[model samples]
Target: MEPVAENKRGLMPGGVAKRRFKLSAGDIIFSILNYIFFTLFTLICVFPFYYLFINTISDNELVRTGQIKWYPVGIHFNNYISLVNVNSLGTSVLVSVGRTILGTSFMVAASAFVGYLVTKKEMWGRRFIYRLFIVTMYFNAGLIPWYMNMSMLGLTNNFWGYVIPGIVAPFNIILVKTYIESIPSELEESAFIDGAGYLTIFTRIIWPLSKPILATIAIFGAVGHWNSFTDSMILMSGKPELYTLQYRLYIYLTSTSNLSALMNSGGSVNTSVLNSVLNARTVKLTVAMVTILPILLVYPFMQRYFIKGIMIGAVKG
Candidate 1:
């Protein structure tokens, strides 16, 4: 027998050879094209944020003149300092942080609990309850009606406004419900046989086993809350103190009169430092980064679980 080619075989026990699969020419070309496409796509997707970051660090004049591209020119760090010095900075940060934590926690717990309840066949009105959620996915009260309802509930200008209405998310409930259904029924049966109550079984079995989906949903909740400015804009309109960081940034960018007044403030602000920070080109770029930076830092930690959970939850078992 002719000896097998080294490229076509892998050595096994006692020098026995197993056939090694080789990529076809088409496969290699397809892979190369795939890599090139994704590489270009990534650059396209990333360049805007990169542009914002580099412009943020460049001199305001250089940025405005559109001369600073590919690299930062006349580097300056005072934009960040100016952002920190905003009168509402402390309050905005506090509100954003508080709402993000509280909102994420409440939404995750509510979604998980509702998801678990729906997965139980013995639950009362299971079909009706699930259909109710499905109905929400397709239909929504218009903005005016929603605003009126919230007003009726006295959620306007309330701190709970940030955390309450978002607690019951139909999409999150569906993702979590699908994930929970994929779990083995035997586990719950075993728990029930050991005299475990519904809450106990959920806390002990479901919660721990559901980490991937939970982490995915938690990241969603956190990002949604962190980036949420519309809710603050409408619900907390009367309360400047409750404004989130993103909304504060919005006010800073849009209110030219306010920006001018801030730039001219003589008290506490050093003339040179204030001048550096008040530049339109720099402040907006820096504030944009400041608003999104936390979410950017957080996503990497959750990315692995996010991918896994989303893939698994997409298919109903």
Candidate 2:
């Protein structure tokens, strides 16, 4: 008998034949088109930040003339170094970071607890309370009344002003509620049968299960708190110590004198050289980069949860 012919494709260690899979022509074309589309889309989204960064690091004179684009030219650290001269820089960073942490925590906790409470059939006036929350999303008193309320509550010029008002965000609560409703009710029932209290069920089972939505709301809260300067602008008018990073950046943008003073603070530098390489434009770009970098750094870590949470939470709503 003739020896059995060997397969052109070699067998695996387990003696399973390795199959070669080839993409169809349509699939290959579709994949190429998808890659091209996404590549262009990514570039579009990223160019603004890249443009800002390069302009900040590039020669201020060249940047001012609009010659610097797509890459750095005659790069120097002066733009960054000059930022140290802003007396409020360190305090503003601390205030922004502190508020982001505290505010996000408070918002997430409030959203989760309220979200969970509203889902229960046994909770008193759950429907009316939930409807009230929904109603807040559609209506608001004007800025004057809002400010008066804050002043009456004595939140004016207070750090808590940044955090407390954001605690009952109806939108976030709705997202959390929708997501929580998707959780299996059997899990809570089982916990209840085992002598678990409502608080225990929430802390142990519901909270852990709801991590995706919680993280989503956390990202929202963090971004909102980090980017918000209007509240600080209105409430902390006389209190520079409580001014957030965004508010400080706004002040710098609107005040060329402030930027000039900061640039001049670079000790012992030749006045002409400072004037040449450091200007309001470069300073503004550098400040923008600084303000946005933290959030950019943080968003990647939570992106998976963000997408998942938003998708699941939005499914019902």
Candidate 3:
């Protein structure tokens, strides 16, 4: 401890400190690029929501008077209140919810079972059958044929009309099959060695292992069913009584939006152009939120599965 390296010239008694100025050209370029992309994507994603939110709460005069509102403009929630306005929106929500649950369950369960069978090595030339299903996915039999088929079977305007025909999706089978392919064929063989029947192996092993793919399929199928407008429009056309949420909302917007025709096509009442939104644009947005929000909530949960599913397969079982 004689000198103890404790001289005053020893910057810290043991060592000297150093500072650095490090900024590579690549770093600076990436910094600028990151900021630019962040801003661009922010605007791109935000604008439509901004438009919807602002219009939803905006006063008609402000919107119609040429004052663009990038934010809330006086909070007129009456549109949402009225659209949801008690039992109407609630009932529509129920219809959509019911359809989504039943339809997705029907599709996932049925497609998964069929997918399991189709994926089996001993299924003996399942490729031709699978191809037939996939072909139907690309080339539909057209509206008239579909309508005629439904009519012949009396499914048109029936509740089954919504849940049955499209419940077993071909592409969903492919996705589940791909995931199933990742599973070990040895697992099934082992189960067979233990006297487990096909159903037992399917229910106990394949079903459990297939959850991720099933969840991914569930989200897609549920969203499809929830957002289904075309099917409802065609099948329930004359029977508005059976119209689903999207279909009913479309009908409401169409019937209500044209105020000019309703109030006499060419009359000059100088109140502002934004009043047009009142006709049914407001209703349309409200209904859209109603139909979409539940699925948006669903999205966060299944999103990981769907993302991973595109890349990975389960270990072959």
lDDT of 1 at 148: 98
Residue-wise lDDT of candidate 3 within 50-101, one digit each (tens)? 6766776777556545465577677777777776453355665666778889
lDDT scores for all predictions? 0.87, 0.88, 0.77
Candidate 3 positional error at 130, Å: 1.4
The worst-scoring run of ten residues by lDDT in candidate 1 lies at 4-13
TM-score versus the correct structure, for each prediction: 0.85, 0.87, 0.80
Candidate 2 structure quality by residue, lDDT tens digits, 1-317: 96555455676656788677899999999999999999999999999999998898888889878998778999899989988876778899999999999999989999999999999999999999999999988899989999999999999999999989999999999999999999999999998999999899989999999998999999989999999999999999979999998887787666756545766787455666546445655777888899899889999999999899999999997
**Ranking of all predicted structures according to lDDT, beginning with the best and ending with the worst:** 2, 1, 3
Ranking by TM-score: 2, 1, 3
lDDT, candidate 1, at 271: 66
Leading candidate by TM-score? 2
Off by over 4 Å in 3: 1-25, 64-68, 84-88, 256-279, 313-317
Residue 27, model 1, lDDT: 98
Q: Looking at candidate 3, what is the lDDT of residue 86?
A: 32
